[model samples]
Target chain A: MNRRPVFLITMLCFGFAFFYIPILSMIVYSFNESRLATVWGGFSTKWYVSLFSNRQVIAALILSLKIALISATVATILGTMAGIALARFRKFRGRVLFSGLVTAPLIMPEVITGISSLMFFILLADWIGWPGQRGFTTVTLAHITFSMVFVTTVVQSRMVQADQAIEEAAMDLGSRPWQVLFDVTLPVIFPAIMSGWLLAFTISLDDVVITAFTTGPGATTLPLLIWSKVKLGVTPDVNALATLMVLVVGLGVVLAGILMSRADRRRDADARLAYQANE
Target chain B: MSKAYKTGWFDRKGWSDIIIGLPYVWLVALFLLPFLIVVAMSVATKTPTAPPFSFGGDYPLLNWEGYERVFSDGLYLRAFLTSVVNAAAAMLLCLIVGYPMALGLVRVAPAWRNILLMLVILPFWTSFLLRVYAWMGLMGKNSWFNKLLTDWWNFVVPVDWAVNSIPMMHTNFAVVLVMVYTYLPFMILPLYASLERLDTTLDEAALDLGSRPHQVFFDITLPQSVPGIIAGGMLVFIPAAGELVIPTLVGNSASPMIGRVISDEFNQARDWPMASAVAVALLVLMVVPTMLYSHFQAKSGGAK
Candidate 1:
């Protein structure tokens, strides 16, 4: 290798270490049998055991999972519909407005989003009888607003890559529009739907700011619980919780990647077989 | 059957379009309506000592008091300036740290690339608050690493500079350090995507002519990567300006930033009008840079 490559590699290694060391240290310290998180007081799973018995941590974890699942599923469905409309229909009157509305959450400051949603929910509750006393319902709604944008982007890109000719052919072969959609478009975009669902799930799971605004006293998510606890002081149990979360999220990501790669391989194989048949 | 196949928005035969259109309507109602409410609330005067705050009156649309107070107050102005400055510094730090990592990842072997990319994004999967707490533990005064540093330095040297210089917590430096770490991947990923798409032949051609490596980089690579830089900078800058968590967690309350000011107005002072004014000011400050970045992105044909 050239000297340039060596220099670049060294520089990059330093950068990576700067980013990774603190996080890696947190993971390591979680297993240490010390009340003070910084000290290496022998290896033990005491904190993990304590974390398991902590009611606050357990409740927050369960609530966070429920919020993530519900919001991700809802957002994925809504976003897929929006993506199909945007891709298939071109000359809508409010197209620009709709596009702006969809992307606004992606760029707007979270503080602004949080404050605005809080204000809206308060006012809505005052006027209407629905969504009484903001809590999990409001938090899930806020998450869906933002997470749907990610899902829409993913699904739209996938929809663009799909061949519309197949749908046209299905229609010509005596299939109704709904049947053609079910038989052709749905199957083709299923992978995108899965990816979109995963993206929404992760985004909702990781959200803290918006969830903070909308959550009432009894509805703390894991991140919210961690945040309030940190304000007082650090605890070893939080570290153990963080370690478990990192493991779960990391596993989900790895599994999703494996499944996506498998799908891509199958698609490639099918394409090759189709070409062979034509020859 | 062909006559019934009219695919327009108003055509009733395609009822699926109505279902598809519902999400857009929900977005507008839930997302856009609240934003409009914010705009409305910003301009409306707050009633003195009331349960239900009302914006009703003859001149409901105009409240110069909020805007005037925000501009006239030195503390608010200074906070705004500090936020802009801090965001700029954080952006510069992210570029210095992230660009090289992006370059390395793209050039590395295929087998290592996936794992390396995972490392870059791993932080993003965890709760942002936990990551901040992790940094707090690592950088605290009685932290194990800091203790080790002090002990080692005391043995080797008589000077206490190492111990004194190590900030355990509650400093501007701590806030900036964490901000850089938090946003580093955001900066790196976009630049990496751009760099990966760049043709190697362009660099070869430049070298084939009599261009030095430095010249080729500045002329060919830097210009091409401008879009990535702008995109990444906007990602870091806009949020950093309004960020309340890192500064509140690590820095002193005396450190002026827009986020702290707005938060104080809401929580500590219970002054909604002041908070709204500060929020409006922050939004106004962000608008110019956002428009400029969008224009640049359009010119470069990058994703908006």
Candidate 2:
């Protein structure tokens, strides 16, 4: 059918190569015996061993995971509510301002966000004694503030596309507004919510600049550690750590792909069965 | 009209009000308040006290001295220029590399499209710092990547002009390269969204009217995808300009970007007012362009 254009294929090939080559090289070099990242020596797992032994790296990884988990969960909850208000509620006081807040984080420079939030925390500490210091708690709050914008957009789109009749029907059947939201709307939008959570989690985990501003001493994240270490030079231990992260992310993506395709196939089968019955 | 359904007490409007009010409060406190504080800090005087900045002492409350320094200092001005140049270059490169791939994804068969799109986004899921570090490894002088580039350069040019290595690291070139790599997905996704929704029937009609493929694309596809182009460009450009990680990691330390300057002023020099001034200036630079872009976007949207 001449659908496969030569120019398009070439572009795709080059683009994907440019994207994957650096990461693939890092993974390959992680196994290299040589201390130098580029020089190929015999494969070894010593870097992996060293990465495990480094207590700072391990502590940073744990801290990052904890922050990602807590921030993503809280952001998802807040974002979903905001999404519903924008999508379901026709009119509210200051609706324009609400929408602006949701999208501002998407475009605002990370530096501005980082600096502004740091100031906010310090001001809060001076005014009140709660969160007496800026550390993990402060970083988590900052991440949630920004990452929730992404979550809101995701959930808002899903909610906008969702059928309203189901929720209306539930409400018609004597269900409370909260019940309609919980039983009908939430279930329908659960997939979007889950993906929103994942998006927030990854963003929080990978964040460097914002975390740099918000985090205090003894609360270093993985990216912060890697940044400081790479300033010294790329070590084999960091390469090993990157490889493990790639492995984990790769598995998660492939699993999601498989699940999506299975769902699609099931939907196709259902449609075909209905068509056959009608015939 | 008869009221068919009863509104339960629990389902009343108050529930919705409370639900929405909570997030609004959180945003006002966390997001808006912080920015306001920055604005205040920008106007404050630098002091030797604990917080390092004070609103008023012997000096006037609205101190324009930090902003005066930002405007007069050549170093800060140069940093601003470098940031604009570097970010613009990265944005242009991303557009060039991303446009074709996005077009390809839209044109390809459905079976392979999803997989390819996944590939485009999969790298994004990995840590950005690690990805930049990988470039550092590649661009370093004794690496195979640099050697390969050096060999290619030597092959193309006369032997005398060629050197041992191209010296890729610690330069604006490396910064832009890593930026394009990191932000290519941001450019591609919006572009694909707009490109995929394009009416192919318009292209078919143009072809039937004796237009060539290139002519049809320029006339129909390119004009229609302008929205996507703007969206992608802003997404890449804004972040690339504000970007601290890639520049500090790969860029030459001789001429720091504005983001670096802000960090240095805040952390190293302990100049909160000056850093806040720079931050405020950077925000102004970004916001003006953004407002113009959205204005154009709305104008074009309204025309359609």
Candidate 3:
């Protein structure tokens, strides 16, 4: 037991060092005053201040956030509906197709998805001219397509494990089907929905390949900007940007972790109270 | 319970129908239709038109020329091989590194488990591109990290065998390193999920039955975690195989991966049909392993 724990701790330390060293260096260098990224100079916050003033990066950030938000919300709704249909309406016609479509995106590589969608958009525009040009709308649509699968998988798994008796009891008490869904089913699966939304949001935000293909001129994203900059040459401003993003995501995770632990404690307390009442 | 109340105004069947139909319609339009376009374009001949390909008017509806080109061209074959090799290496490395951490996660005190798991997931919240870029900073020829590695190497090797800096950037080593760093979490989380569920009594029984600790792990823990291994392998392998950014930023341009080939063929060469052909073939290649994974999954699930 003693030996095992030592080995485990050593492994975790090494693994975490491998993961964090790169990120830590990036964050540290972001504060460097040197224009050269690798060279260390006295610490300064000028790069971060410059990052905000850089209209291109700022525009791309806003665009990415908007796309992530809208696509995640839409994907969540559509995916939850699909999840409910899959879990509750098992014997429906086209069930196989429905299931297949839901799982297909999981395995499909982003490159293939990207090229195919780009072609599809081009052909669609040629056919109808409805979207005339590819930009935010096309990027958002592409995001929604890929992200909905994650949402569906999350929601469906939760839905399958959901207590059906509560929903049935609600229905038996003269509640309509919609009422049972809104009042019972939705509440039970709410956590899954929220997680699904988060997953979709993150996926959309991090996406480069799919967005690279689907996006047109003026639809540049943060990843795209970073990619171009890295290709041209690494710069200090990118380091600053990377650091800020790390801080934002780190804060978000900490907040989420705290909330999750609190929620778990509350649930435990509620269960304990009910147990004592029974005694 | 009272008799089931019939819906007087609203039809449950109708609502269910709409709910089911929405995703079906959306997927068919966006997902299915787009894939069909690629398949169609793969058969079309390149043209001077805006979309750069045409299927109708004198040209035959189907042309196997693109497919023929892909098979004959050594570039595509080499790229596919590189992708598979790199992805497999990355997957194996991730497993080697992640398994212990995951095992540790399962063995830790229950109160600390969630906090530890959060630590594993924390780095993932950061931008993946940024993380890869960080590797670029570390692996560059003039960087302090490279200097440290080179200094260590010089100490180990003969004086005559010493060099200034190991060419880490634009090499397979850089690609694999970044990939392992990026996908290690994918490997650990799944492994942890399964390892946590393992019945410790089985391990203890093996230990008591005269098996060594290593023997018990091989005979018990390793066999049990095969499913996690496979899931993690797939999760890492699939993306790593199709990965464009990692290879583009860090990898040697001489031996481009399939992703770069597709991107280059489309964006640089303007060979849309050829790119489509390669993309389709790549999809076909990926599907075989994915299907094998599914088969293994089904077998394991059935056993359970």
Candidate 4:
């Protein structure tokens, strides 16, 4: 047990390298002076300049952000509801069905989900005469449906791990259910909710296949735009865009990591303080 | 307590109802109901119009043609084969690459584990499209990575067989490669979660009783992680089997995967019934493993 399995360490490092190399290459090639993604003429920021100026990409990016924002917010609210219900209620009518629905999306192929939802939307339009076109509304709806799965999973785990005694005690102290919820339950699972929102946002932003199926020609998301561009072949402009996205996502993740660690340490201090005060 | 708060509409029963009922209705309407609709559309006939499958043509309107085509068509069958093969290869490769890494994270000093786990998850946060696109750049003809591989191929293979850059783009090889890369983190995270919970006492006892480390690993660790493996495998396999992006971007067009076939049928051919049929078939194909995965998940008691 004491022996450092050198093989496993090498495998770990190797796996990380495999993950990072393609990302690093994309970043490097984004600065390429040549129009070619792979071939380096000299280091230049011309591609970034063009990428920022590109109206289509800009439009797509803005639309994606808008969808992500809306989807994440709605999914978080709904997912938090579902998570609490699952974690606390223990059993209810159609509980089995509800759990199945939530977890199915987590594993279901996007193509099937995408196609089925598209047909479902079409049927809705034909029958109800609403959502007449598969545009922003349809795409946003599709995103919310799937992205909520991540949110539910995240919040569910957190809710399960959360100490329910506090809520019980709050009720005993004459806190109404809503008061206990808002004051105690919500605060305890706040970080999970935040991360869940973030996950939903990213999932919505990054989706392509489902978005493709549900989106109209008018509603091209960032991933869709990226897909169309990359399908032709790798271009330096796309590389630049990819690099910028990678940096943004990477920074967001690092910031989140730091915040979480700080929060964790603060939690430890709070636990100790609570113990001392109790004594 | 406040009088106004006490008389609020959200009573205890009301609160519970809202919490459970809202998401429940949303899911049934969007998720479960759509699948049933897909099943209905699968057997309908394709007509030439907006919402192409018509209800006015025949009273019963149960055109088994789409079903027949799905059952009998070589293209559909071949596509299924390609998807399964490529996805299976990717799933196996991910487990191979990720298992050791997961074990290492658990084995390493406690201080480094979270950081390493974060590294595994960081890529997952970035745009999946961009991640696949990164591989495209690496695999392109003039790319240094491809050129390096080309040189290696040239060195190893017979002189006549070696000429130019390796065709890493637009092949099943590329599809599987990218799928493995895309899904490696999914494999690792679940494996890590399961492995981290494993008791070391059993391993210590086995080793102290004269069993070798590898023996202890095979006899104790591997058997216990069956649920993890199934979870991870299902996670990787199901999605990879139905992956649309990688196949479209990098796969050989002549040999389309199941996902690409369904997309093309719907988008290009505009055969709604056929697309629905294919989608139904794909869903049916996925049912066995999906059920197994859910069963394992329920037993594992992770999340509902």
lDDT of each: 0.80, 0.88, 0.87, 0.88
Estimate how well candidate 2 is docked, as a DockQ score.
Answer: 0.63
Clashing pairs in 2: none
| Candidate 1 pairs with clashing backbones | B141-B168
Ranking by DockQ: 2, 3, 4, 1
CA displacement after TM-score superposition, residue A164 of candidate 1 (Å)? 2.9
Candidate 2 chain B lDDT trough over 10 residues, lowest sum = B1-10
Interface RMSD of each: 2.8, 2.5, 2.6, 3.6
Q: The CA-based lDDT of model 1 is what?
A: 0.80
What's the TM for model 1?
A: 0.92
- Model 2: per-residue Cα lDDT at residue B40: 85
Predicted chain A of candidate 1: TM-score: 0.93
DockQ of the candidate models in sequence:
0.54, 0.63, 0.62, 0.60
Of the pair 1 and 3, which is ahead by lDDT? Answer: 3
Instruction: Give a tens-digit lDDT track for model 3, residues B1-304.
Output: 2323432112365786788888889999999999888888888888877889878566467878888877888988888889999999999999999999999888888898888888889888778888889999998887779999999999999999998998999998899999999999999998998898899999889888898888888998998988888888888999899989999999999999999999898888887888899889888877666768757785976598
lDDT of 2 by residue, A139-257 (tens): 99999999998999999999899988777677777776678777888899999999999999999999998999999988999999988998888788889999999999999999989
Q: What is the lDDT of residue B205 in candidate 1?
A: 94
- The DockQ-derived docking category for candidate 2 is medium
Encode model 3's per-residue lDDT on A1-279: one tens digit a residue: 447888988998898889888889988999999998888888999999999999999999989999999999999989988887787774778889889899889888788898888889988998998578899999999999999999999999998898777777677677877788788888999999999999999999998889999898999998888888988656899999998898899889999988998999999999999999999
Model 2: residues with Cα > 4 Å off, grouped in runs: A1-4, A270-279, B1-11
Q: What number of clashing residue pairs does each candidate have, in the order they appear?
A: 1, 0, 0, 0
